[model samples]
Target: MPPLPAFNPSTECPPPGRFPLTWDEIESELVKADDFAESSTRSGLLEELRVHFALVEMATGAVGRLWLAGSFVSGKLDPEDIDVTYLIPSDAYVRAMADPDTVDNLDNLGTKDWCVRQGLRVDAYVLRLAATEDFRALGVTGAMAPDDHKVFESLGVYDEVWQRCRSGPNGIPRGTRRGYVEVVL
Candidate 1:
């Protein structure tokens, strides 16, 4: 074979401050999404988005949880965007990404547009089961299904939070005027 191209760090690598997110950070976002999911006025769009990926696992056999993270979960006011991730089994994650149909399903989900309509940034990812574990922990069994529930349980986010977000908050009355149009997920 011909000589391989030499490695180029500058062009190939992310610059300073741009790094793959850590498990600890994901844990923190669990808290943030839980809290944000609690705020009735703020969580309208997010709540609607909770179900867009229901068909994800069925389509790919990727058993995992969905996560919302980043600056929006960091308690920053008017964060540039909201970050979401689908934590799935390692084998399934690879397969899903490689399949065009899976990609198309994600595209049709319109997660990014929904976030933008609410005036927020959107950074989403699909993390493998192993990557979701706390490497620093002494006894890490790796990810489990129902993976999403495990994430919330591991991160100390109560079912009440999930329950509230799922049940739908008592939103503002219609025809009463609103700054942003309600999104349908």
Candidate 2:
């Protein structure tokens, strides 16, 4: 891998939507994600969840925390795919979507797009906070398809893995033991 240029944070256009959150706000969400992953891990799922976290951290930038939804988090022992979502700034979303380099890179999110493009089970949505709220409130209204509604309604943040991911003096108690890669901003 080569050293990339510093993120200017000024060269990208925001994606079309509402509820774009700042980087710090997204970190708070990560805490929730850490907890969720911790609570849901069984013998077969922990490594998959950890790998997903590592890949998202390694490949993504300028995004908020990752979300685990669908059958994986809904108590299904064998989920077809690990449905992961990320709350990214609209501008960052636009930049990633347009960049050819980001395509095909799972860590880069090209794999995410490709999975969606092929209608694979690894459901992914890079949405804003407002969009998330709408999904929560509307519960898959008439405007949204039934399958889409199922995915949206499956956002479960409650469970044992709800432990904090942070460590050290400023960290929360019962924090996670699984290793994680911090998302590049």
Candidate 3:
């Protein structure tokens, strides 16, 4: 949470089988949240992910985005398995094969293998530009909405904490308001 330990791009090493990312590369594309908490602990975790996504994007050459999704974003980090979604272009699989050093596809097996090599727990999915039934079911509408970007831009841990710590028993959070965290590229 302590301002995420001043991300030093030079010092960051990519997870196993992944390439390293430079601080400048990530800083150039990094997005800042309008609302950030004073707690360094929470902030550090977020920053770590920012770097991670930057690397993912760099390695894949596919537009990538990260969201606080899952229990952590919903202010329920106690569960330990923080759900995160990494949106990669559908062509990422092809790209991986072409550039083995930077990208590697393990089939439709979600990017968990990659994440595991890096010591992170994640649920990654490749999103295609084409509008398919699966895409529709996932609620992706070709491009990101203004509000959607705003939500990511203004993301913070406040709401999740409030909903969990303040909600009474049997008042579990539900709906799009509580179940998901979205990140787009």
Candidate 4:
């Protein structure tokens, strides 16, 4: 497999300090894996999750709950992207929007752009707490499915799977736009 690209969070115009694991950082974390065990993915996922969650906490000043609601948690290894949901309180939205820095940081453009800039094939979404029930249901159903290979089909899961089973336009959106940060790959 080819190496993943690096990501730099800093911008010349507004100058947001670099965030979380850069491409080098992610690679180092992945390289430390003993033999691509489940735990290895879990560790790498956790690292990425922490970085994403920290950005939310720092930008919103509100600590929200995070749930792994996509292929990563559903036993799918060939995930095209990471999927997660941030349960942010409704009350915090206004405050977050009032602050330009927070709003700017919350934009998918910044996150996506950062990943592309780093050469990493990653995409992220932010979903509000209120929108998670459906996602949670989808995740649970996928997890309980009998066939690991068929789990994606069982719940109509896609985005991070092998090409043969990739979903079409009906596939779930890469990320939800309402939450603070719903998905990251």
Candidate 5:
């Protein structure tokens, strides 16, 4: 795999592209990129990400893919929260939705508002399951279901949105954009 790229100076963001990494690698690399003063804050934010991941897996049985976006993935110092996108397979989504016990977890895992209410410093979103570069571990095969089309569409939107800079306090992007990293499970 290629090394993680440096932040684009102008936007203070990661260069526009996909960087697939592991949890260990994300901690070792992404965190180390921040200044010394930001170390503790970065660690705490990473912990929140771990908690968010566990919640997603508990609710869905599997996270088809995990994506890291927003300021947390950028070169910025002391980002308030980490933005995460969990791509959940349809089968897992159905199971999670059908279970009353997992509803709150699903709800928390699905939206940014619910996550804030739960006191999780994670801006979360769940999209139609996406295929990783290597799908073997994820149990996705060569076969493409009709719904895969929607998954592609969903991913495209994420790519487009995440690639842009959060222009103002409201996060309405006004043209400027950046890149994000994907967690390799």
Candidate 6:
């Protein structure tokens, strides 16, 4: 993975796309880089996210990669929360959705609503991948049905959507693009 870029002065966030980082790098860059009042807050949030990630994976068994966005990934001194977008395997999604036990965890991880309800500062979203393999080389294979080709298209849609965010760090809708951090679990 490449080194993360500095935050934009205006958006207080990095440029748009996925910036993959190792577990240690994530802790170092996002948490320890800033020596401020919010350092402890960031540390706590990281731990909370670890537990949440494990719980989600145990329930659905679909988490392949995790992208961090929102204020926590920004230059904010004291962000209220961390935003997570779970990149999951398509087959795992089917299995989890079909399984009866995943309902509660899946339902609770629906969006940012769980943040307020649980008295935590973590938000989540889901983006399913066509396969757990190289996505760049992926396309409509002859073995796939015509309708199923849309799955590949959906990946692009999710990429675009996740790449876009408010231009400002205060959550105002200024329509700016910012990259997210993919934390290695």
Candidate number with greatest lDDT:
5
Worst 10 residues of 4 by lDDT: 9-18
Candidate 2 regions exceeding 4 Å error are: 1-41, 106-122, 128-185
Show the colliding residue pairs in model 1.
80-121, 81-121, 82-121
User: What does candidate 5 score on TM?
Assistant: 0.81
For model 1, what is the C-alpha lDDT against the true structure? 0.42
Global lDDT for candidate 5? Answer: 0.77
lDDT of 1 by residue, 43-155 (tens): 43343334444555575685565654333333333445445555566668668779898877655443677445644345444445543444454244543333544444543
User: Which prediction has more favorable TM-score, 2 or 3?
Assistant: 3
Name the TM-score of candidate 1. Answer: 0.38
Off by over 4 Å in 3: 1-40, 64-67, 77-82, 103-177
Which residue segments of model 6 deviate by more than 4 Å?
35-40, 132-141, 145-148, 167-175
TM-score of each: 0.38, 0.35, 0.41, 0.44, 0.81, 0.81
lDDT at 64, model 1: 62
Candidate 2: C-alpha RMSD to true structure equals: 16.1
Candidate 5, residues 89-152: lDDT per residue as tens digits?
7778777778887877677566877776777789888775643345454455545555666778
Error of 5 at 166 (Å): 3.0
Backbone clash total for model 3 is 7
Candidate 4 residue-wise lDDT, 66-131, digit = tens:
433334422333444455444455457557778887777878423766754644334555433332
RMSD of 3: 13.1
- Better TM-score candidate (4, 5): 5
Of the candidates numbered 2 and 6, which has the greater lDDT value? 6
**lDDT string, candidate 6, 1-185, tens digits:** 66788877667788877898987888788888854445658888888788777777887775878888788888877778888877777778778878776866777875567765775568877666564344444464554533446666776776676677764556646777887788776
- Which lDDT value does model 4 have at 14? 10
